[model samples]
Each structure stands twice: as structure tokens, then as C-alpha cells.
Target: MGIMEILMIIIPTTLLWAAPLIFTALGGTFSERSGVVNIGLEGLMVIGAFTAIVFNLTFVDVFGAWTPWVSLLAAMAVGALFSLIHAVASITFRANQTVSGVAINLLAAGVALFLVKYIYGKGQTDIIQRGFSKIDIPILSDIPIIGPLFFSNTYYTSFVAIFFAVVAWYVIYKTKFGLRLRAVGEHPMAADTMGINVTKMRYYGVLISGALGGIGGGVYAQAISSDFGHATISGQGFMALAAMIFGKWHPLGAMGAAIFFGFAQSLSIIGSSLPFLENIPNVYLLIAPYVLTIIALTGFIGRADAPKASGVPYIKGSR
Candidate 1:
């Protein structure tokens, strides 16, 4: 293919792969910014994927073209509800936050698998008839080089993901709730003294994470996989966590990191098609994204600092 054609293909594919990561990483940003260590993002994503596939399969006939979108809502609701287990354990009962998150991951996987078997009598669900499709933006897709590379043949979810990243940045840095969320995460005792309701803020943070994470999973299922399976999520959630840390807990930063990772992921799948990369071994291509993730997390981008009170449960009057 010519360079322009290749660019068009690669850029759109990267966005497709990046959209879910953006959502998940943004979710991580919210949870971490509020001082809760959300190790269960992977589990939350699995729950989302499963719920989305099942709902889409069941309702595609009823909802028609809107099935996938409606399924995302179902995933979001279920994800939020499932995350309450973590919130109650970590915030209400003062359990170790890490342990609570891990439990959520384990519980979500087991519950999802069990429900899948019980509902389908099989390991994976059948593909839905109405998954997301790429669309060329009306006038924008016709605007020369930039249009073809960015707007042509793009999933709507990709734009939504980018839009939400900007919204996330504003919500975290410019809003009153954002200020209180940061305050609670940085110093729960101080926030509590200021009548910030530290517990309530943390709960809100975790719930938001769950909702976004669920959307991430749903997007992956409907736009990429078209079905749910044991490997549906794979390690996308951990990769998103890596993006959050690599971005230094900033929303726009995480979105940029996710796009980078998405590019790496797209290369792994499309490398053989490119003349320069075709000579490289397939194993290296497959492992590039993971290697890059480790590099990003291991100080390749300088020191990344977590919130001061992150992972620490707050007792009402404790010092």
C-alpha cells in the first residue's frame, strides 16, 4: 500500500485499539486521584464485557442498531454495582484496599464465568448481530489528508473516548468535586475535618471508575471482539493501569499514553503488512506492547508519584 493509504489504515486502527484503553486508564485516574487503589479494574472490565455481550445478544432484536449502546449502559450499571463490594470492604469495613480490590477481581471473574456457563451452557457467548460499525464523518471525512487519516472509517466510540478524556481532565482539575476528591485522597483526615465527607468522596471515585471501566469493556466487546470469551479482556485492564501510572495520574496524559500503547498494539497486528516491519519476528511484535508497558512503569518516564494517602484506609479520628 502507498504511504497515505497505510497511514489511513494504521491511524484508524490505532484509535480503535486505543479507545477502550483510554476509558479504562481514565477510570484508573479517577480512582487513584481519590486515594483508592483500584487493582480490580481488570475484574470490573471482565464484568463489563460479559454483561455487554449478554445484553447485546439478548436485546439486539429488540434494540436493533442501538443494542450495543444500550448494552454499554447495562455494563456500566453492573460494573458500578459490583464495585460496591470493594467500596464497602475498603471504605466501610476498613479492609486492606489492595486485598479488597484483589477480591473484587477474583469474585468478578468467577461470577461472570459461572453466569456465562449457566446462561449459555457454554464457555463463550455467540456473536451479536449488531456490534458497532465504523462511519465516515459527514463533511469532515472529505477534507483532504487530515480527514482521511483521522475522520474516515472511524468508530464513534473513539471520538467519545477522546471527548471523555477532556471531560475527565476538567472534572478532576476544575470542579469543586474534583478539589474535594483530591483533598480526600491526599489527606483524608484533613478533608474530613473540613467536612468533605471523605468516605462519600472515595465512594464516588470508585463508582466512577467502575462505570468507566465497564464502558471500556463494553466498547472492546462490541467494537473489537463482537463476543465474550475467557480471553476477551486479556490484560487490557493492566495495560490501562500502566497507562495511568505512566501518565503520572493525569487525564490527558493517560489518554496520550493509551494512544501510544494502542499504536504499539496495532503494529503487532499489522507489522507483517508493512515492508520495514515484515522482517521482524512475530514474537517480538506480539510482545512489544507488554514490554513497552513495563518500561513505562519502571521509571522510563521519570518518577511517578501516587496520591499521599492512596491505599490507606481512613479511620474517623486516626492520625
Candidate 2:
């Protein structure tokens, strides 16, 4: 295929795949920025995928074209509920945050698998028919090559992701709530002295992460996977966490990193379809993004830092 052809196919596919990662990374940004570490993102996504699939299957007949939109909200709610498991453990009980997150991952996976097996009589759900459809923008998609590349019909979730990114950036930089949230993440004691509720801020942060992570998983399922299965989420949460760290916990930065990883994922599948890539091993392609994540975490790009208070649960009235 020519470069243009690749661009046309690659760009849309990359954005579609990356949408979940970008949103999930941004969700991580909220939690980590507010001084809580959320390693349970993987679990949150799995829960989201299950919930989305359930909603899509249940409502598609009634909702018709509106299924994906309604299901997205359902995904967000279920996701937030699932996240509360981690929050109660980490924030309220003062358990090891990392351990709590790991528990969530295992719990979500187990619960989802069991439910799927019981209901579907298998390890996966029936694939949903309704999904986000690509729509070409009127004049914008018809311009030049770049138009088709940028303005053509694409995953609605990607558009929502971009919108969320911009909003996240604004909320982080411009809002008073943002300042307090960052303060709680960076220096809870100092923020407490300023009359800010550190506990509340952290809770809000993590809850938002769960909500977004769920939507992220749901979006991924509807747009790509089409089914709720144990393997559907498959490490996407960690990829999002890595993307968040890779992007320095900034919304726009996370977006860029997510897009990069998305393209990496696309490369794995799309490569096999090309004449030149037919000979390359698929295993190497599958592992490339993860390898890049490791390199990024190891400071190949530069010094990477997280909130100083991250992973440290707060005990009321204790230092």
C-alpha cells in the first residue's frame, strides 16, 4: 500500500484503538494527580467492558442507533461503582494502595469471567451488533489528503476523547477545584492546612478514574472487541497507566502518548495484512508497545515523576 493508503487506514484505526487508552490515561492522571495511585485501572476497564457489553446486548433492540451512547453512560456508572471497591480499601481502610488495586484487578477479572460463563455458558458474551459508526465530515473530509486523514468518518469515541482531553486540561489548569486537587496530591498536609479536604479530593480523583476507565473499556469493547470476555481488556489498563506516566500525567501529553500506543497496536494487526509485513513475526509486533512502555518508564525519555503522595493512603489526624 502507498503511504496515503496507509495514512488513511492507519490514522483512523490508530485513533479508534487509542481512544480508550487516552481516556484511561487521563483518568489515571486525575487519580495520580490527586495523590492516589490507581493500579486497578485494568480491573476498572474489565468491569467497564462487561457492563458495556451487557448494556449493549440488553438495550440494542430497544435503543437501536442510540445504544452506544446510552451504554457509555451505563459503563461510566458501573465503572465508578467498581472503583469504589479500590477506594474503600485504599482510601478508607488505609490498605496498601498497590495491593488494593491488584485485588481490584483480580476481583473484577474473576467476577466478570464467572458471570460471563454462567450467563453465556462460555467465557465470553455474544458479540453486540450496534457500535460507534464512522461518519465522514461534510466539506472537511473532502479537502485534500490531509482532510481525509483528519476529518473523515471515524470513531465517535475518539471525538469524545479529544473533547474530554481539552476539558481535563482546563479543569487541571484553570479551575479552583483543580488547584485543590493537585495540592492534595502533591502535599496533603499543606493542603489540609489551607482548609482543603484531602480525603475528599483523593476520593473524587479515584472515583473519576473509575468512571472514565469504565467508559474507556466500554468504548473499546463496542468499537473494536465487540464482546465482553476475560481477554477483551487484556492489559489495556496497564498500557493506559504507562501512557499516563509516559505523558507526564498531563492530559494533552497523555493524548499524544495514547495515540502512539494506539498506532503500535494497529501496527501489530495491520502489519500482517501488508505484503512486506507478511514475513514478520506477530509476537514481536504484539510486544512492541509494552517494550516501549518499559523504556519510557526507565527514563529513556527523561526523568519521570508522579505525585509525591501517590500510593500513600492518608490516616486522619496522622502524619
Candidate 3:
């Protein structure tokens, strides 16, 4: 394909792939911003994907065309509930945040697979009967290059992700709750002295993180994977984490970083078709996003600051 033709195909694919990352990374932003390090986003996403797929498969007839959307809600609820494990372990019990997160990831994987076997009598759930379809925006889709690149044949969740990122940014930076969340993250003792409830803010952050992460998984399953299995979620959760770090814990920044990763991911599939990349090794293209992630986290992009009290257990009266 010519450059313009290639561009047409690549942009939509990139955005489609980026949608999940954007949501999950935003979830990470919420958790980390509240001074809790949630490394279990992967597990949360796995549960979300599995729950969404199973719900959609089981209820497609009843929900008709809305099955996917409803399944997303189910996924979100499950994701939040599962995240409570991490919240309790890290916040209430004051366990090592990283260790707790790792446990969450392992637990999510084991439970999801076991449930798949128990419920489906197999290793994976049936493919969803219906999945999210692409649609063009009304007037904007009629625009020139921009329309074809962004508004045409795109998943609605892509726009929703961007909108939510903006909303998350507003909530984290502009609102009263956001102020308290930040205060707790930067200095829990100071926040406690100011009468803000440190544990409460942390819980709020973790719950929101779970909700968004679950939604991300649901969107990926409904729009991309179209099924639930051991491999359904793979490692997108970790990529989202990388995006969170790449973006310096800012929602908009995370979205941008996700888009970049999405672009790299898309290249793996489309590279074979593009004239310039046609000769490149598939291995290189497949690993590009991950390689970029490792590079981003290694300070090659300069040091990124995290919330000061992140991963630190807040003891109410301790100096």
C-alpha cells in the first residue's frame, strides 16, 4: 500500500488498540496518585476480560444488541471487588505494595483459569456472539484526512477513553477529592494533620483503579479479543503500567503514551502489508512496544517522579 493508504489503515488500528491501554493506565494513575502502588492491574484486567466474555456469552440473547455494554458493567464490578484484596492488604494490613500487587496478579490468573475450566468445561470461554462494532461520528466523520484517520469506522470506546482521561485529569488536579488524594500521596502525615482521612483516600483511589482496569479488559475482550481464555489478557496490563510511568502519572500523558504503544503494536500486524516495513522481521515488530516500554522506564526519557508516599504504609501517628 502507498503511504496514504497505509496511514488510513494504521491510524484506526492504533486507536483501537490504544483504547484499552488508555483505560488501564488511567486506572494505574488513580491508584498511584493516591499513594498506593497497584501492580496487579494485569490481574484485574484478566478478571475483567474473563467476566465480560462469560457474561456476554451467557446473556447475548437476553440483551440482544446491548450484551457487550452490559457485560462491561459486570466486568467493572468484578474488577473492583477483586481489587479490594489489594486495597485491604496494602491499606489495612500495610503489606508490601509490590508484593501484594504481585499476589493479586497471580491470584487473578489462577482463579480466572480455574473458573474457565469449571464453568466452560474447557480452558476458555466461548467467543462472544456479538462484539463492539465501529461507527463513524456524524459530521466529523465527513471531514478531510482527520475524519478518515480518526472518526471513521472507529470504536466508541476510543472516544470514551479519551473523554474519561480528561475527566480523570480534572478530578485528580482540580477537585477537592483530588486535592486530598494528592496530599495523602505526597505526605500522609500532613494530610492526616489537615483532617483528611488517609486510608479513605487510598481506598477511593484503589477502587477507582479497579473499576477502570476492569472496563479496560471488558473493552479489549469485546472489541479486540472477542473471547476469554488464559491468553485473552496476556500482558496488556503491564504495558498499561509502562504507559502510566511513561506519562509521569498524568492522565493525558498516560493516554498519549498508550497511543504511542498502540501505534507500535499495530505495526506488528500491519507491517507485513506496508511496503516499507514489509521486509522487516515479524519478531522485531512484535517486540517493539515492549522494547519501547523497557526503554521508557530506564530513565532514557529522564527521571519521572512518582507520588512521594507511594508504596509506603501510612501509620496514623508515626513520625
Candidate 4:
């Protein structure tokens, strides 16, 4: 393929793959920013995926093309509710945050599998009748090089993800709530003394994480997988966590990391078709994103420090 042709194919595909990661990584950013380590992001994603698929399948006829979009909202609600399990266990009871997060991952997977079997009498749900579709931006797609590379044949969800990332950045850096949230995460005792209601802020952080993570899962199912299955979510959530850490827990940074990972994933899926990549082993391509994730987390890409109080449970008056 010519260079332009290759660019056309790769850019759109990268956006498609990045959308879910952006959402999930942003979720992780929120939770971690509030002194909670959300190891259960994977579980939360699974719940969102399962819920989105089920909701889509059930209402496709009634809602028509809007089913997938509406299903995402449902996933958000379910994800937030499910995340309460971790919030209560870790925050309310002062349990080990990591253990609680792990429990959430396990519980979400088990519950989703059981419910799938019960609901469909099978290992996965039937594929949805309708899912997201690519479209060309009205005026933008008419531009020369930039148009086709960025605007043509793109999923609306991708744009939405980018928009949300910008919003996340604004919310985290330019808002009063953001300051309080950071205060609680960095030094809960001090924030509490300032009358910030450390517990309430933490809850808000986790809840936002859950809701955004749910949207990530729902986007993956509707725009990528088109169904709910045991393997549907797989390690996307973990990859998102990696993105968050890689991005140093900043929303825009997470979005950039997600896009990079998405590029790696897209190469894996489409490498064989490209002349340059055709000679590489398939295993290498498949493992590239994961390997990069490990490398990023291990500090090879510069140090990424988490919030000082992150993963530390806060007791009202305890030092």
C-alpha cells in the first residue's frame, strides 16, 4: 500500500481501539486521584460490557440504531452500583484496598459469567443487531491530508472519548472539586482538618471511576466486540490501568497513552497486511502492547508517582 493509504487505514483503526482505553484509563485516574487504588477496574469493565450487551440485545428493536448508545448509559449505572462494593469494603470498612479491588475483579467476572449462563443458556450473548458505525465528519472530511487521516471513516465514540478526556483534564485541574479531591488523595488528614469531608470526596472519585469505566466497557462491546463473552473484556481494563500509570494519572496523558497502545494493538491486528510488518512474527505483534505496558509501569519511561495517600485507607482520626 502507498504511504497515504497506510496512514488512512492505521489512523482510523487506532482511534477505534483507543476509545475504550481512554475511557477506562480516565476512570483509573479518577479513582487513584482520590486515595483509592481501583484494582477492580477490570471487574467494573466486565460488568459494563455484560450489561451493555444485554441491554443492547434486549432493546435493539425498540430503540433501533439508538440501542447501543442507550445501553452505554445502562452500563454506567450498573458499573457505578457495582463499584460501591469496593468503595464500601475499602473505604467504609478500612479493608486493604488492593485486596478489595482484587475481590471486585473476581466477583464481577463470576457474576457476569453466571448471569450470562442463566440468561442465555450459553457461554456468551448473541451478537447485537446494531452496533456503532464509522462516518465521515461533514466539513472536516473535505480537507486534504488531515481530513482523510483524522476525520474519515471514524466512529463517533472515538470523538466522544477524546472530548471526555479534555473534560476530564479540565475537571481535574481547573475545578474546586478537583482541588479537594487531590487534597484528600495526597493528605486525607489535612483535608479532613480543612473540612473537606475526605470520605465523601473519596466516594465521588470512585463512583466517577466506575461510571467512566463502564462507558469504556460498553464502548468496547458495542464498537469492537458486538457481544458479551467470557473473553470479550479480557485484559483491556488492565491495559487501561497501565495507561493511567504510564500517563502519570493525568487525563490527557492517559488519553495519549491510550492512543499509543491502540496503535500497538491495531498493528497487531493488521500487521500482516502491511509489507513492512508482514515479515515480523505474529507473536511479537500480539505481545507488543502488553510488553510496553510492563515497561511503562516499571519506570523505564521515567518515574510515575502515584498520589501520596493512594491505596492507603483513611481512618477518621488515626495517624
Candidate 5:
């Protein structure tokens, strides 16, 4: 394929793949920034993917093209509802956040698989016909080189994600609430002395992570898999978490990192389709992303000093 043709497909596909990661990674940023370590993002994503597919299949004929939007709402709601378990365990009950998050992941996996088997009578849900469509900017799409690489054939959700990345950056850096959130993460006792409710902020952070993470998985199902299966969200949430760490927990940085991973994934998939690359083993490309995740995490561990109190439950008297 020519450069333009490859760009036309790869760019849009990368953006499509990146959307869910962007949202989920940003959600992780919120969670970790507020002293709650959420490893249950994987579970939240599966819940979202399943709920979105179910909503899409149930409402496709009635809602038509609006099914994707409705599914997004369903995903967010389900994600938040499910995350209540994690919230209660970590924030209220003072359980180990890592253990709690692991529990959530296992529970979500079992539940999602059971539903797929019992309700669908198979391993997967029916495919969705209604999904988000690409939007082409009239003037920008006509430009050469950068046009197809950036503007042309862009999904609406991609732009929405870009907007959210900017908004997230502003909200985290520019808002008073952000200050309180950081305070809660840094020193809960100090924040409490300052009249900030650390508990409430933690809850909000986890809940927001859940909701956004749900949207991330839902968007992925709509675009990439076009269906919900037990495997639909497998490893994706973890990948997003890796992206968050890879980006040093910054919103825009995480967005860029997630998009980079998306491009890597897209390139791998496309490589097998190309004439020359068809000879290479697909297994190598398939494992590249995870391998990169490991390298990033290990290499940056020293530099990525998470929030001071992350994963630590705050106690009134213990401190």
C-alpha cells in the first residue's frame, strides 16, 4: 500500500484503539492521584464491555444509530455500580486496596463469563450493528500528508477523548478541587486538619475511575470487537494502567502514551496484512505491547513515585 493509504487506515485505527485506553488511563490517574490504587480497572472494563454489548443488541433496532450512545450510558452506570464493591472494600472497610482490586477483577471476570454463557448460550454476545462513525473535517481532511494522518476519517469519540484529555489536564492542574484531591493523596491527616474530607475525595476518585473506565471498554467493544465476549476486555484495562504509569500519571502524557500503544497495536495487525510482513510470525507482534509494558514499568519504577499515600487507608487515630 502507498504511504497515504496506510496512513488513512493506520491513523484512524490507532485513534479508535486509543480512545478506550485514553479514558481508562485518565481514570486511573484520578484514582491514583487521590490515594486509591485501583487494580480493578480490568473488572470495570469487562463490566462495561458486557453491558455495552447487551445494551447495543437489545436496543439496536429501536435506537438505531443511537445504540452506541445509549450503550455508553449503560456501561458507565454498570461500571459505577460494580465499583461500589471496590469502593466499600478499600475506602470504607479499609481493606488492602491491591487485594480488593484483585478481588474485583476476578469477580468481574467470573460474572461476565457466566452471563455470556447463560444468557447468550455461547461465549459471546451478538454483534453490534450500530457503532460510532468517523467524522471528516471539510477543510482539514483535504490537506495532504497530515490530513489523512490527523483529521480525515476520525471517529467522533476520538475528538471527544482529545477534548477530555485537555479538560482533564485543566481540571487536575487548575482547579481547587484538584488541590484538595492531591492533598488527600499526599497527607490525609493534614487534609483533614484543613477541613477536607479525604474519605469523600477517595470515593469520588474511585467512582469517576469506574465510570470513565466503563466508557473506555464500551467504546472498545463498539469499534474494535463489535461484540462482547469473555475475552473482549482481557488485558486492555491492565494495558491502560500501564499506560498511566508509563505517562507518569499526567493526563496529556497518558493520552499520548495510550495513543502510542494504539499505534503499535495497529501497526502489528496491519503488518500481517501487508505483502512483505506476512512472512513474519504474528506471535512476536502480538506480544510486543505487553513486552513494552514490562520494560516501561521496570525502567520507570524509580522515577514514577506514585502519590505518597496511594493504596494506604487513612485512619483517624493511626496516624
Candidate 6:
């Protein structure tokens, strides 16, 4: 393909890959902003991916094209319910947040694999026949360079992810709920003194993390993996966490960071097909995203400011 053709291919692929990251990073934002450290995003994503794939396989015919979207809802619901474990352990019982999150990750992996073996008698679930396919936006896709690069032959989920990023930014910074959520994270005692239920805000934050993280997993399975297996989720959740921190925990910043990482991932996948990158070794390409993640965390952790009370369990009536 020519240069223009290559750009067209790479740009949309990057966005498609970035969609899941955006969703998961946004989930992290919600949780951390509300004084919760949700390291279990990975587990929630696995559950979401497994649940969505199972639902899609079971109800593909009945729901037709709507099956994937409905399956997304199923993922979100299960994700939220599973996140309650983390919430209760961290918020209700005041257990160590990191330990609770780690436990969640281990539990999700075990449960998903157990269900897979029980249901399929194998290590992986059956693939769905139909998934979210590429769609060219009407009128917009016809625009000259921008249209061909972005609007044409793109996954609808990518646009939805972008839209939600904007919505997340608005909800996190512009609304009353956002103010209270931030307050609870920064100074829960002060928030409680003002009659804001710190526990409730923290719960909402963690639940939002689960819901969005699940949706991210669902989208990834449908758009890329098309099946659920032990390796289906892999390290994308951690990558999302990295993106959240790299972006300074802001929604739009996370979106940008996700897109950058997604581009790196896409490069790894497509490097062999490109003219200049074709000469680079495949191994380096494969490890690029993870290496970038390490660099980003190490380079930015000192400068990036987390929520003041993140990972700190709240104690009522303790001044």
C-alpha cells in the first residue's frame, strides 16, 4: 500500500485498539478519584470478556445484531456485582485495599477458567459468529483526508468510547456529583462533616470502575479476540492503569494516553506490513507496549498526583 493507504489503515486500527483502554482507564479514574485503589480492573475485565462471550454464544440467534450490545450490558452488570467484593473488603471491612484488589484478580482468573472448563470441556469458549463490524459513518466518512483516516470503516465502539471520554470529563469535573466524589477522595473526613456519605461515594466509584472495566473487556473480546480464554484479557487492564496514571488521571488525558499506547500496540501488530517498519525485528515490536508502560510509570509516577486518600480506607467517627 502507498503512504496514504498506510496512514488510513494505521489510524483506524489504533482507535479500535484504543477503545478498550479508554474505557478501562476511565473506570480507573472513577475509582481512584473516589479514594479507592482498584488494581482488580484486570480481573473485572476478564469476567466481562468471559461473560460477554458466553452470552453472545448462547443468544446470538435470538438477539441477532443486538446480541453484542445486550451482551455488553450483561458484562457491565456482572462486573459491577463482582466489584462489590472489592468494595465490601476495602470500604465495609476496612481491609487492605491492595490485598483486596489482588485477591479479586486471582479470584476472577480462577472463576473464569473454571467456568470455561465446566462449560466447554476445554480451555476456551466458542467464538461468536457475529460481532461489531466496521461501519462507515454517513457523510462524515466521505470527508477528504480526515474521513478516510478516521470515519471510514471504523468500529462503532471506538466512537462510543471517545464520546464517553468526553462525558467522563464533564461528569468528573463539571457536576455536583463530581465535586463530591473528588472531595471524598481528597478529604473524606471533611466531606463527611459536610454530610456527604463518603462510603456511598467510594462504593459508587468502585462500582463504576467495575462497570466500565467490564464493558472494556466485552469490547475487546468482540472487536479483537472474538472469544474468551485464559489469555484473552492478559495485561490490558494494567496497561489501562498505566494510561490512567500517565494521563494524570484526567479523562481526556487518559484518552490521549490510551490512543498513544494503542498506536504502539497497532505498530507491533502491523509493523511487518509497513515499508519502513518492515525492517525492524518482530520481537521488539511485540514488547513495545509493555516497555512503554514501564517507562511511563517510572518516569511519571513521581510527578503524577494521585487522589489524596486513594488506597486509604475511611474510618467513620475517627478524627
Instruction: Give every collision pair in model 5.
Output: none
lDDT of 3 by residue, 10-32 (tens): 98899999999999999999999
Q: List per-candidate RMSD values in Å.
A: 1.4, 1.6, 1.3, 1.2, 2.1, 1.6
Winner on TM-score (1 vs 6): 1
Q: Please list all clashing residue pairs in model 3, or write none if there are none.
A: none
TM-score attained by model 2: 0.95
Query: Where is model 4 poorest over a 10-residue stretch in terms of lDDT?
Result: 285-294
Per-residue CA lDDT of candidate 5, range 1-319, in tens? 7876766778888898889999899889989999999999999999988888888988888888788998999999899888889989999999999999999999998998898898889987887788777778788888887877898878878877878889988888899988888899889999999899899999988988999889998898887889887678878899899888888888998899899888777777787776667798877766766776677667654465678999899988686
Write candidate 2's Cα lDDT for 218-284 as tens digits.
9999998998876899899999998898888888989888999898888788977766777998788
Candidate 3 vs. true structure, TM-score: 0.97
Estimated TM-score for each candidate: 0.96, 0.95, 0.97, 0.97, 0.92, 0.96
* TM value for model 6: 0.96
lDDT of 2 at 135: 85
Best by TM-score: 4
Error of 2 at 93 (Å): 0.7
lDDT for predicted candidate 4 compared with the true structure: 0.93
Candidate 6 C-alpha lDDT tens digits along 1-319: 7988999889989999999999999999999999999999999999889989999999999999999999999999999999999999999999999999999999999999999999999999887998888999999999888999899989999999999999999999999999999999999999999999999999999999999999999999999999999999999998898889888889998999899988888988988889899888878855666676566667653567888999999999887
Error of 2 at 223 (Å): 0.5
Writing each residue's lDDT as its tens digit, candidate 4 over 110-179 gives 9999999999999989988898989999999999999999999999999999999999999999999999
Best-matching candidate per lDDT: 4
**In model 4, how many backbone clashes occur?**
0
lDDT value for model 1 = 0.90
